[model samples]
Target: MTRILAAALSSALLLASASAETLKDTLPHISVTGEASEEALPDRAILHLDIVADRLTATEAVTENERKTRSLSDGLVRQGVPIDDIRVVGVTLQSVATEEAAPRGAHGKHVSRGFRARSELSVTVNSLDEAASLLSRAIDAGSNDLRGVEFVVSDERTRLERLRIAAVKDAEQRARNYVEAVGAKLGRIIEIDHQEAVSATEANGRTEPLASASGVAFLRLRPGVRRLTARVSATWALSR
Candidate 1:
């Protein structure tokens, strides 16, 4: 009975697909796909780093790492970052074994080398002005590894929505242009399929860039022009 039910569901899906394909192929329409992305300056930066301490014992390593983490957080606050924005994301204590650090046994086995304690930190900086200083302070305070600094637009959802709107408009315009070039008129839209659409709605709000206060250039890092793509395939009827 289970096998029979599965086969029936599969057959229904196949028939539905075939019906849709028949309409797509038989309809007198012009189909076009459009792609677009959003671009704007970054409004926020996230700094990721690890505060690591290596010692002969796990307790020593953990103690040192905790001290360094405190220092790191304090330094970031001093650099104008909000205390709440700094986060200790993860902690790890592990014993590492190295051929050179550990002694070789009779059967070529290795002994305990060292214990490393690491703390991961994620800091969100609202203003880019404090990013460099905060990063430098983290290193000075005992941050061992600099993972990466992510530049981001806080209105990411809205930006993606705009990209989808743009792509839809692009497809519509393309269909119109094609019909016009062929001496025909574009009629009603038959199908609108977003192939690789991001889950976003149309947004009307837009941000205006602030003008520079001075002619002298200050090194400001912004998330450069980014392409967020939304692909749309649209079919429209053509009238002669």
Candidate 2:
């Protein structure tokens, strides 16, 4: 009986020591989240313009729409804009009922009067100086539907990489501060996770039609500052 009791007590002691070691291994790390933002003026401009035409038949409407789009494209090219930067993004053709077509019929049936055709174009201008002139020329070329305008940096990828580094540095600094406050020194990074970058524009709103007298003033419509933010969550090993 004494021998059996001694063996059981020894096994229990070894199990307790193993559990204590596992707890220590899991609790010796620190984690923190950090975020940072950078702002820069946009160097590129993207303009959205549309051409709409209505005619007695679908074929006539489509032909007119194509003619107007061609005119707009040629006008931009004449002003030294690159042909590769201009692209047709959307096209639509649908029959529209005019008042004349809605006249009461013997069988109370509605007739289709004409068809409307619309074409949307997306233009990317590298130089801010040419943004206003390009838009004005497109409007003069029969592009009456001005949809929207967006400003962006052509080299945003490089800027975002720099912000990522800054965010990691910011996290390290915070971890060090916390470790120091607890009377310990910072150690190697055990784990790291980078969050997606959030991008925002300072004045991202639809622009109104340019006044006939304010052609040059359109250049003053500057693409305000663009802000890019980065966040990171990092875990570092703790050291005494």
What do the candidate models score in CA lDDT, each in turn?
Answer: 0.74, 0.80
What TM-score does each of the candidates earn?
0.65, 0.75
Pairs that collide, model 2 = none
Off by over 4 Å in 1: 1-26, 37-39, 101-109, 182-187, 193-230, 237-240
Model 1 Cα lDDT, one tens digit per residue, 42-142: 66778889998989999999999999999888877876788999998899999977644435553444667789999999999887766655666577678
Candidate 2 to truth, TM: 0.75
| After superposition, candidate 2 runs with Cα above 4 Å error | 1-27, 98-111, 196-201, 205-219
Residue pairs of candidate 1 with colliding backbone atoms: 37-228
- The alpha-carbon RMSD values of the candidates against the true structure, listed in the order shown, are 9.0, 13.2
lDDT of 2 by residue, 2-89 (tens): 9999999999877866754554478687788887788878877888999999999999999999999998898888888899999999
Angstrom error at residue 168, model 2: 0.5
> How many residue pairs clash (N, CA or C atoms closer than 3 angstroms) in each of the candidate models, in the order given?
1, 0
lDDT score, residue 76, model 2? Answer: 88
